[model samples]
Target: MAPLSDPAPRLARAAEAPALAALVERAYAPWVAVIGRRPAPMQDDYTARISAGQTWVVAVDGALAGAAVIEERPDCLWLDNVAVDPAHHGGGLGRALLRFVGREALRRGLPQVGLITNEKMARNIALYQRLGFEEVERREEHGFRRVEFRIAAAHLAG
Candidate 1:
């Protein structure tokens, strides 16, 4: 695994939208075949997201390595998109981003952080569970079968 980066994630700037979009595409490329089409996140408007201050990017030695888009909801922080460049997989960047999401939720006075993934992505589900998120529901929407998970403040405290 590549050495992890030390810099904290920063708010994404508008100029980085293309790079962020590419990173997301590379990270989710393997799932295209499995899901029968591009994932919803792959088609998101990163420019708009960044402009709204909903995106964050992490860099390693000045190179972008991962990105996450979090939406602040009425009751929880919604993790909309999280992707670590494929070359940087297994370096714990994804988990770090998740933890950041939890922290952001707490900072915003939210009670929980929630996310959803394709139901067929078993490994992703397991990883989230191991990180304290509990499977809350399963449903089909937007032509995909999704499993929703949430990590409550109490769960994070534990």
Candidate 2:
């Protein structure tokens, strides 16, 4: 199959919740065995997330390809989840979404963007570091060992 072009990210509509949920499942499926259980994103409530306006999706050829779920925190935009369809991995969609998160933080007048990932996802940690996210801490949260990262919104400004 031909590679799809990365499209601009946009707020996900309520109708896209099902598709987004599926995308999250496909994106996080690989980590299930590594984590010894289903990843948190897999069990998320996408319908509520969409209604809350915290879900953003990237579509290619009118199909959902990637998504980022973010909440506006007092100090920064908290990225709750970022998912790229496994088929789209390594195509730069994930990077584009991270950039979008940074832009969203700037738009919201927040100083930074923050996120957490399972410590078992070594590649994700490296990718975040490469993109300028600084590790803030690591601790157990909700029965999972999580690594938190933050990036100044200024670093992501165009």
After superposition on all CA atoms, what RMSD does each candidate show versus the true structure?
A: 2.4, 2.3
Candidate 1, 1-158: lDDT as tens digits: 34453337899988899989889899999999988899998999999999999999997776679988999999899999899999888877787777777777888899998889999888898888887788999999999999999889546533
Report the C-alpha lDDT of model 2 over 1-158, residue by residue, as the tens digit.
Answer: 33433457889999999999999989998999999999999999999999999999988777789999999999999999999998788787787787788888999999999999999999899988988889999999999999999999878644
lDDT for each candidate structure = 0.85, 0.89
Off by over 4 Å in 2: 1-6
Best by TM-score: 2
Error of 2 at 125 (Å): 0.7
